[model samples]
Target: MFAEEQNPTTAVAGRRLSDQQAVAQFRQVVSRVEPVAERFCKQETADRENFDCDIQIVVDTSMEGRNAYQTYNDAGKPVVGFTIPMIADARNPDELAFVLGHEMGHHIGQHSHKQQQQAVAGALILGALTAYGQASATAANPYRYTGNDQRDMQNSIELGAGVGQMAYSQTYELESDVIGTAITKAAGYDPVKGARFFARPEGKRTANGRLSFWGTHPPDEKRLATVLATIEGIEVSGGISRR
Candidate 1:
């Protein structure tokens, strides 16, 4: 996030660019990434009827944090949103490119839908177990089957669903990193330096193990390593040279 008094100049392609200049560069990055998204959709969804790559980029000035996310609109089209603070926080065009590519990776990988499916499956299993446990309890003591007991059972099922959703969140985050590295490289950006954004103190600070196993994202260190390895592998294979 950026404070109101923060400097307006940002680094872009090793040169300082004002906020307006940076925004223009960000738009150019979006333009380059759009074709990459289209190519991915063509390769991944050619068999499906009426499937087309539709990605919309939204800049929300009202947002408070340095964050970006991918989601589907009401029409099922993928949307990537960047907060003003996030844009302001980006030190260079490559940082913005990597962030945009990362969000695109989420859509390209269909992580949103896949994660929902995982959560639903987990919730169903948990709900079944809770039902079985409640039935067993009621069978052992018929007098225990009261309104409060039913409410508690419902609460347990909800809690199980929440836990289930979190269980796979970290997995999806890692997967996104892999895909995002490729996407950033394909867009002709230096994913390695872009990845260094995660190595910064603020980025490292966010990876605390408070939730550990239940965290929504893996530790920043792990993510940084994955990005480094992925980019190295790609280079070794002569995929794309570092920009």
Candidate 2:
């Protein structure tokens, strides 16, 4: 279904923009979307003290494949970055705008912060369980703690952290789509059209075997549906309302 919808020969995906054109469009999209995103961030985080809306949007020239991300710098300032290929792969300004909005949504949603907390909690829970099981076995057999107790706990903790991070991954993606749709529309872009960027059939890994955009942001019907639903809500409300 995705392949049919994002047919390279017939759709915008068919043509690749020049490096110069790609950069130009990205900058233009940023000019329009950045302010709106910042304002939205501020509005959403008004009650929080020192919640930084000073987002830094940048491009990673050294990275390969289509990808974008939101992270915090050492000073705790939000940073949204796009790989060079990600910019070049964008079919239109709306795509760039929506992608930028989505990245901003991650920060605004405080996803990273929440994910870290979840990781720590999950790790503790699983690690404690492992330790308790080890102690019980040691008491029962008196020889079960020969060597692998620490290794077992460490492995369990790592696995728990991964599971915890994944627990709300899909929900977070949908939430970001909702926020992105609002920001894209506010920035005068067609979010539904922009979201078509995700409709293309891609693999989890790129040619070099590194994780690709689709690897992290797996394209699915649910995501597109979320965008459409958000648009519907926006139209009904005559504007976006925080959820």
Candidate 3:
């Protein structure tokens, strides 16, 4: 889904680091990027109230696949994590830096909060529409309480919630890339090079039969375009624009 300029193979392709090398590189990247990301997060969320900018970085050694994520703890602090495989799978430190920054961007964008709201709104709208249809049908035929109506309405509501959650998935990803590019650059990594980690030619799952990184962070031309555009803006304006 990328053009020649955005090809996946370059610089670090086909180069696999040893386990020791990989772990060391991951730690080095985290040391540099984590502080930068936290500072950036605070700066971006300064005007908002109760915005959690205390980002905690963690590693899930039990996870066997290549994946990273952002989640909240029991106390609502943002936690960004990278699996062991995810760290080992990185071709270079730039990839790890970019991935961490992207996860931080999710928090900066308040995506989880917005997604929950959207899902509720979508579920309510679809449930109401289904209820209206059922009522109309019952009005026409008073004998239409076959238990299928409730099941169908429930299914519609679930589908609507899923649709709502996904409606802004692409946009959210692009926004993260925009923020990630700026963060990666500020952390002394090349955002474009880091983004190339996504343009791999592989299935959605890894060899161990678990979902791969691409399964969640699907690559497309738009993602590359966004990173490039963000880099351009940073170079021209010397900072990231407010999203």
Candidate 3 residue spans exceeding 4 A from truth: 4-14, 206-211
Whole-model lDDT for model 3 versus the true structure? 0.84
lDDT of 2 by residue, 1-243 (tens): 345555667555446888888998899899999999999889888999988888999988877667899998898889999988889888788889998999899998999998999898889899989989888888999955458777888999999998888888888888888899999999999998888887777788988888788888888888788888889998998666445
The root-mean-square deviation over C-alpha atoms between each candidate and the true structure, in angstroms, is 6.5, 1.8, 2.2
Candidate whose TM-score is highest: 2
Clashing pairs for predicted structure model 1, backbone only: none
- Computed on alpha carbons, the lDDT of every model, listed in order, comes to 0.68, 0.86, 0.84
What is the Å distance of residue 169 in model 1 from its true position?
1.5
Candidate 3 to truth, TM? 0.92
Candidate 1 global lDDT: 0.68
In order of appearance, the predictions have TM-scores of: 0.79, 0.93, 0.92
Candidate 2: which pairs clash?
A: none
Kindly give the stretch of ten consecutive residues in candidate 3 with the minimal lDDT sum: 5-14
Error of 3 at 200 (Å): 1.3
Give the candidate number with the greatest lDDT. Answer: 2
